[model samples]
Target: MSDPNRPGHPEDQPPQGQPGLGPTPPPPPGQYGQYGQYGQYGQYGQPAQPPYGQPPYGGPGPLSQDEITWGSAAHWSALVAAFVALAFLGPLIVMLTKGTQSAYVRRQAVESLNFQLSILIYGIVSLALCLVLIGFLLLPIVGVVWLVFTILAAVRAGQGEEYHYPLTIRMVS
Candidate 1:
């Protein structure tokens, strides 16, 4: 059943326009806030800006070129080595080893590098524990695990999302 509160339902809803006058005038540029500033509808139902310090469009502009860089997860994911050696561990290492000052870059770096590093660490740890399992067992596991995680990280990177590794040893700055 249709709810009365829902629009287009025959219920207590005010028809658009008919604000008691001619066609509603286009909201002035500042009607919703100043250029590059946000505004909201006022008493007469006009646009007004959001609170101060907020972007005029409601938030900061979309991602920039700097945000979409080579060191980004996208690039890391695409790299063959990332799929082979790092899987998740390579990107994690590279991300952590990044030297840039951009928070975005640093964040991505940390993630990609961390994931790769984790897999590497796990493989090493598992191999060293050969007494518990056969030596060759970890090889295929590492390969498949690396491939899956590498692609996952790469996909995230392509979307410009950051990747972080867990339980990593911060060897480099």
Candidate 2:
């Protein structure tokens, strides 16, 4: 039982204007009070299904001409940064931005990113081998190969054709 001496106790006093009754009972199930029915908060308790004939939420839209241009640019970005040894940043930027809008651009960007990363790995390995004197011979070869493949990929992308670099590890697919 509730204590009568306790402050603000229900047993001590009935609700205002209803002296004979005790504390008011909660609204019955499925009954709405001040807010809507319980658990029906914002964006919740509502059907997640999209209307009929519409694509799913966040699904990739059709590839647009602008997206194709950006896809081509993604490959070219590698060359722009290749001078500074950060070729990955170019494709990465495209993938994070326009890539979200179209699957084609995303695929192109991912391919370039993987190739650049492979080049980085090869460069590092070649540098370590410099201690054995063989790296000195491999370094220039690696650079030339990287340049050629990058240009070829960029050209393919510009033509709206898919390009996959040879000898690239399938990382960040």
Question: Against the hidden reference, what TM-scores do the models get?
Answer: 0.46, 0.63
Q: Cα lDDT of all candidates, in order?
A: 0.57, 0.82
RMSD from true fold, candidate 2? 8.6
Residue pairs in steric clash, candidate 2? Answer: none
Tens-place lDDT digits, model 1, residues 1-173 = 76787766655545456744545555545545655333343444545645679754425555666566645643355355644644555444445554354556555666555555666777887788777776478767865766666666656665766654434556534
Measured by TM-score, the strongest candidate is 2
lDDT agreement of model 1 with the native: 0.57
Clash counts for the predictions, in order: 32, 0
Off by over 4 Å in 1: 1-60, 71-99, 163-173
